[model samples]
Target: MFDVKTIGIIHTPYQQKFGVPRQPNLVPLGTGELHLIAPFNHPDCVRGLEQFSHLWLLFMFNHTAHQGWQNMVRPPRLGGNEKMGIFATRSTFRPNPIGLSAVELHDIVIQDNCTILKLGSVDLVDKTPIIDIKPYLPYSDSYPLAKASYASEKPAIMLTILFSELADQQLLLKPQLKDLIQQVIAQDPRPAYKKKSLSTQEFGITLQNANIRFKVEDDIATILSVE
Candidate 1:
């Protein structure tokens, strides 16, 4: 068996899994910082990394690793009705619990003696343990014509987001996060089962320190509060 060591910890606006985008770059405003640990926190470790536009993050699903995995699992993209092989879907409940994401590299900062990577379009939750980081070589990594059976295209924007007067007032305190909050809510972060049922349920997602509360009615989602 091979042993893996955590090289860094990622800090992001997503404090929990409920609101994180299923795929990276889905929410362009989403940002994060990867702080390298002890031995690997030196500037020499990330030298010449600034030339690349993106990086691939190999991280662990620490939150759900304890639950273990199964051979067959339901994917949220399929509306949670069909069963697919665990390997075929990007489900967090994996045998190894490792996940890969391609994130846009914004900047690399060396402060005090630690190395930190500023990232954009990140889909990871806060305090995610990073196993490894590799430069994303576009020449070989991207395939514009690649075929993804079920997820061939980007998921459509499911809801129209509108902020209430109170929510608007609260947002002024953190104006920079407005676009990020809007894009996240527009994805309709509801469970597959909830999408199928007709009920007035208010949902809340924690981004940073604020709790964004909203309700979805028909194709529109109204932001009730941001506290």
Candidate 2:
């Protein structure tokens, strides 16, 4: 049997999974904490970890259950309509239910009270269990001359942030807010391919005790209100 053990816990701002962004790096300043567990907490484990600016995480889809396996899946990118081979897309529902995310390691502070790794650009839900961590080695990891397939294609639209004066001040101080919103919206959080005869319109997405309503006009997104 192939046994897997969780070595750490990830504390993120995302409490729900309904509208999570596709990639972590897209998050502007999305912040979180990486709490390492004991045994892995031995000082030796942390050695040479500080040299890298980012790390790759392999984790489990604890919230989801396996229902055998499907050779094909309906992806949100296709407006939840078209079916594609599961290997062609990165849907959370899978045979193995494994999840991988790349996150920025801002700092690893070993406090007497607790040892933690402050992080950025996390697209994980709160209290996600992390299976393992590996530093990003540019030599083996980077591919300057790589094809991104369908992913390389940009979305037909873009996300814009228009914050109220109160939110503006808050964003300036904690820029992570802007990044967080972008990460959430950029994935075209709307229902995949819902046809409404409109390319530009206004909508809202909830986050951290705030309701963000935005409008898309002139191909530019305008933050309409925050209530």
| lDDT of candidates 1 onward, in order | 0.91, 0.71
When summed lDDT is taken over every stretch of 10 residues in candidate 1, the lowest stretch is: 193-202
Question: How do the predictions measure up, each by TM-score?
Answer: 0.97, 0.77
- Highest TM-score: which candidate? 1
C-alpha lDDT of candidate 2 relative to the true structure: 0.71
The digit string of per-residue lDDT tens for model 1 on 1-227 reads 89899999999999999989999888988889999998999889999999999999999999899999999998988999999999999999999999999999999999898899999888899999999999999899999999898899899998899999999998887887878889998988898888887766689999877888998888688999988
When superposed on Cα atoms, how far off is each prediction in RMSD? 1.1, 3.7
TM-score (C-alpha) between model 1 and the true structure: 0.97
Model 2, range 36-103, lDDT digits (tens) per residue?
88988776787889999989988888776455558998776566777889998887778887888878
Count of backbone clashes for each model? 0, 3
Which candidate ranks first by lDDT, i.e. highest? 1
